[model samples]
Target: MHAKADQRIRVTLTLNGRERSGYAEPRTQLCDFLRHELGATGTHVGCEHGVCGACTVRVDGRASRSCLMLAVQAEGRRLDTVESLAGEEGLSDLQQAFRRHHALQCGFCTAGILMSCEEFLSRVADPSEALVRDMLSGHLCRCTGYTGMVQAVLEVARSRRLATGPDSQQENNDV
Candidate 1:
């Protein structure tokens, strides 16, 4: 049996470091819920089949396709959208690196790529250019040609390694 399109459920989750709740039909995609109900418009919807990766968000500390997930599936999960990247101080290191390297142009594919790169950096503190490119294979960008994005990721990795020192690099890599 399929859930009625109008049957809305109260979905709750930790979004962008804050507790957020919204009503969504069982059939509603998470990206739609976040954008329409929760006002997380930063998680753009593109190629809803999950190929373009424009709708990526961090769910439980991993990059996930919001368009491919149901709203109910995000309940109790810690979700981080592109909106969470900037703080009062301004853009995050990764975001700053993106800006400096001109990693984005049209910006449609940037949010998803940023989310994926953020997760990548968290798991791999010191990554080679090949590895960064491999990780970027999941995303598609029509504007920047990926050279700038690749450079941004590498620059951020190097900066983070320097900021945290060599000892922390090993620990971060082990994660």
Candidate 2:
């Protein structure tokens, strides 16, 4: 149902390490809220039916399709968009790998692909090529044929695994 002015709900969430709050209609999609209200445009809305994975984002440290979630449902949750990965020094490790491997072409689907890979790499540090392909199965990319994308994610995961051994298996959940 559409929320009236008085019925508009308040949604507070932590985004990119910063606390942010916004008002939303009861039926407002999380994808719309992020792009329009929160200015986190990096989370793209592709098919809007959650098939393309273009609206992927990390909600409470897990990859989710923003298009399939309602804004009000995200209250009290921590959201991390693609914009959260950047730093003053330069791009994040995943982004760097994507660049080095030429993983992206038009870049429309790059954000979602990277986000999915982020969540995957967090849990699996030493993934195989088959596993990487399986991880990317949910995403659809017409350009680059996904070869570069898989390679980029693999590179990041391998390096991170080496840096953090069994004694220090810290997950990269600091999005």
Candidate 3:
């Protein structure tokens, strides 16, 4: 009989608007791959079993728990981490809104929360307070209650609507 050997899988994905390629074991979690292999430590790993949303990231514009997905499973997918929300021009609308609204505390859960909020706002521009609460139920934050986060999301939605007019709601759906 032959002995079992470690398997390395190659994956290519778009990360933070750039193309990234790497090789990892089939069992390697996406969170580890992003933080260790790719050095994208912005994706935190609070709970490895998907209980906490600290490892949240956008996979094809959908918020997903990186700890639950294998690195190989993200092959040929588009991934966006917290780092992508900022640039030379400064923070994106979501990042700015989080900061302006004081939605973060201890900063441990900020990245994941922002990622989830980004996804949520993209899907529903003007989400109700109840909807915001329900959407954020998947995440856990020990520092701040859901009040600040929900308010930040709503603020961003309102700003987008005001800046682009009511028709701007359609733009968020494409994200």
Candidate 4:
């Protein structure tokens, strides 16, 4: 009898603050690896061509398209999906802001939008409407006109500033 060979490659990475190790095909997309393998389904897979940005996630604090990246590429890196935004207490401030501003309609694009907004807000504490629009341009939301999404992010920014004061400004500047 012929011996079977292992075709999957070993991939190890930190996902949502937890170290995860798994075997995946070298060509497996990170989105599939996260959802199918690790079961992090919050990272939605929409266009798959990197145009829709619905598979957006944070890799080492930078926004990235999970569908456009391979699972092996995330080796030794820190990855954060939409699920990480919420803690044990409840939804995150950004999530709350999204709800308060009615950012989501059908909710198909909420995960990616939130991830992108989180990245943008981390960099610009108080971004202008135009900036917010530009930053979110990559994401496609068929439900809302994106005005609500922008407003939601802005609301979070305002709240951060009001609650943290100048420290928030300094933190945003540092990014």
lDDT (0 to 1) per candidate: 0.90, 0.88, 0.86, 0.87
Q: Please, what are the lDDT tens digits per residue for candidate 3 over residues 1-175? A: 2222377777789999899988788788999999888999988999799988999999999999999998888999999999988889999888887777778878998899888888887788678999999989999998888788888898888887788788556545645
lDDT of 4 at 87: 94
Residue 172's lDDT in candidate 4: 47
Stretches of candidate 1 off by over 4 Å are 1-5, 170-175
Q: Which stretches of candidate 4 lie over 4 Å from their true place?
A: 1-6, 167-175
Candidate 1: residue 94 Cα off by (Å): 1.1
lDDT value, candidate 3, whole model = 0.86
Q: Which model scores highest in lDDT?
A: 1
Best by TM-score: 1
What is the C-alpha lDDT profile of model 4 across 1-175, one tens digit per residue?
2222446877899999999988788778999999999988998899899999999999998899999998888989999999999999999999998888788988988898888888888888778999999999998998889888888888888888788787547344413
Residue 35 of model 2, lDDT score:
89
Residue pairs clashing in model 2 are none
Ranking by TM-score: 1, 3, 4, 2
Q: Supply the TM-score for candidate 3.
A: 0.93
- Candidate 2: tens digits of C-alpha lDDT, residues 1-175: 4567557788899998899988888889999998899888888899999899989999998999999999999988988889988899889999999999999989999889888898999887678999999989999998989999988988998888887776677555454
The candidate 4 region of ten consecutive residues with least summed lDDT is 166-175
